[model samples]
Structures are given as structure tokens and as C-alpha cells.
Target: MGKCSIKEAYVRIENGQVYVCNMNITPYEKGNIFNKDPLRPKRLLLHKSEINKLAAQTAQQGYTVVPLQVYLNGSLIKMEIGLARGKKLYDKRQDIAKKDQRREAEKEFKVRNLY
Candidate 1:
């Protein structure tokens, strides 16, 4: 059983404090169900300045801050935060096509087995 990083983090503004809610850890993504806690609120690590910036962005309507990945970087757990607006349908389709093309190119690459 493997451990799960954060699946998702939704930022919320409550009483002038930046709060992250709805942290879900799924076994499907984590590889197995070991000490699974689905509805736990994990504390996010961010500097005061970064938190303030995220808080400000979230305060504005239609702006959001989301955690995309959580990984152990050099003995410390770090979360990659993104301040992003919602993407449209066309944008998502373009992203999918780009990914498919990249995968296809990689698949066509030849590698010599020198064993």
C-alpha cells in the first residue's frame, strides 16, 4: 500500500483566513488502501507572502488557487500550488490533443537494447 498525496485542494475564504477544504485521498490514486483517511483536512505548507497572494487571488471573483501535486522534494513534502482560472471546453480539448501527440512521438522513438 502506498501513501497518497493530496488529490485536490479547494481554497476558501472565511473570516479573512485562507482555508483549504475537501482534501480527498483515494486508494485508486495512492495504489492501495493503507491507513486511508478520505475526509481529512491536511495542512498546506506555504510561506506567509505566498499564502497572502493566494488569499488575495481567491478573494477576487472567478479566480482560484488549487493544489495540483504533492511530492517529497529532498526530504520535505511540498505541494505545487497553482493560481488558475477555470479552463473552457476548447482549451481542454487542445490540451488533450497536445498530450496525445506528445505520447505518439515518444512511442515512435527507437532505442537500441545493448544488453
Candidate 2:
């Protein structure tokens, strides 16, 4: 799955169907503005069979479904969904430490390259 920014998007489930809700795709500046509304959110439908299977698994394990990334593949838009469980305080601290370590490593690499 690719990483991308989704400032205003959410996952929605209705009648056992999964959807990417409130996803805003900006209209082309030179395109016909009157024909499209930029403020309107585009609802993306996910594969029903796959989503159903994942939902069943996550439900049985007491995990929640969360959208991790949103991106476009050619003409189709895709969302990466994940089954997530709530993290404990120590888990959060461990994650933070890992992130910090990675960041520091990157910074050191950049500095070494400059020499």
C-alpha cells in the first residue's frame, strides 16, 4: 500500500458494504468547472467479497477496521484498509521510540552524505 495524505476522508460501512467516504478530488483548473463541484465528496466502493471476509475476521477478533491510505491506480481509486486493535500505553511508547530512532538514523545519514 502507498502512503498519501487524506485530510478529509473516512471509512464507511453500510449493509455489509465498504466505502471510502468524504474523499475530495480536486477538479482540474482548466476543465469544465460548471460540470463538476469540487466541494462534493466522491464515494469509492470497495470489493464486497473481500471486505466481507476481512470484516468477519476483524469482528471475531474484536478489532476495528481502519483506512490507512487512499490513492489512485490509473482510472480507479483504491483505499487500503487495516484491522487495528487499541494499543496499550507501553505499546504507544515503544512505537514512539521506534519512530524517533528511524528519524535520527535518517538525519545522520543525510549529515554523513554532506561530508
User: Cα deviation in Å at residue 88, candidate 2?
Assistant: 1.9
lDDT of 2 by residue, 1-115 (tens): 2433456655656677665555555666666747565445445466778768766766664466667876688987677777767788899999999999999999999999999
Provide the lowest-lDDT 10-residue window in model 2.
Answer: 1-10
For residues 1-115, write the lDDT of model 1, one tens digit per residue.
2355445567665544555577665546635647556666666655678777778777776788777776777878666768879878899999999999998777666333332
The C-alpha local distance difference test score for the whole of candidate 2 amounts to 0.68
Give the clashing residue pairs of candidate 1, or none.
none
Q: Each model's C-alpha lDDT?
A: 0.68, 0.68
Off by over 4 Å in 2: 1-4, 7-9, 22-24, 27-42, 60-62, 93-115
What's the C-alpha lDDT at position 101 in model 1?
A: 94
Residue 19, candidate 1: C-alpha displacement in angstroms: 4.4
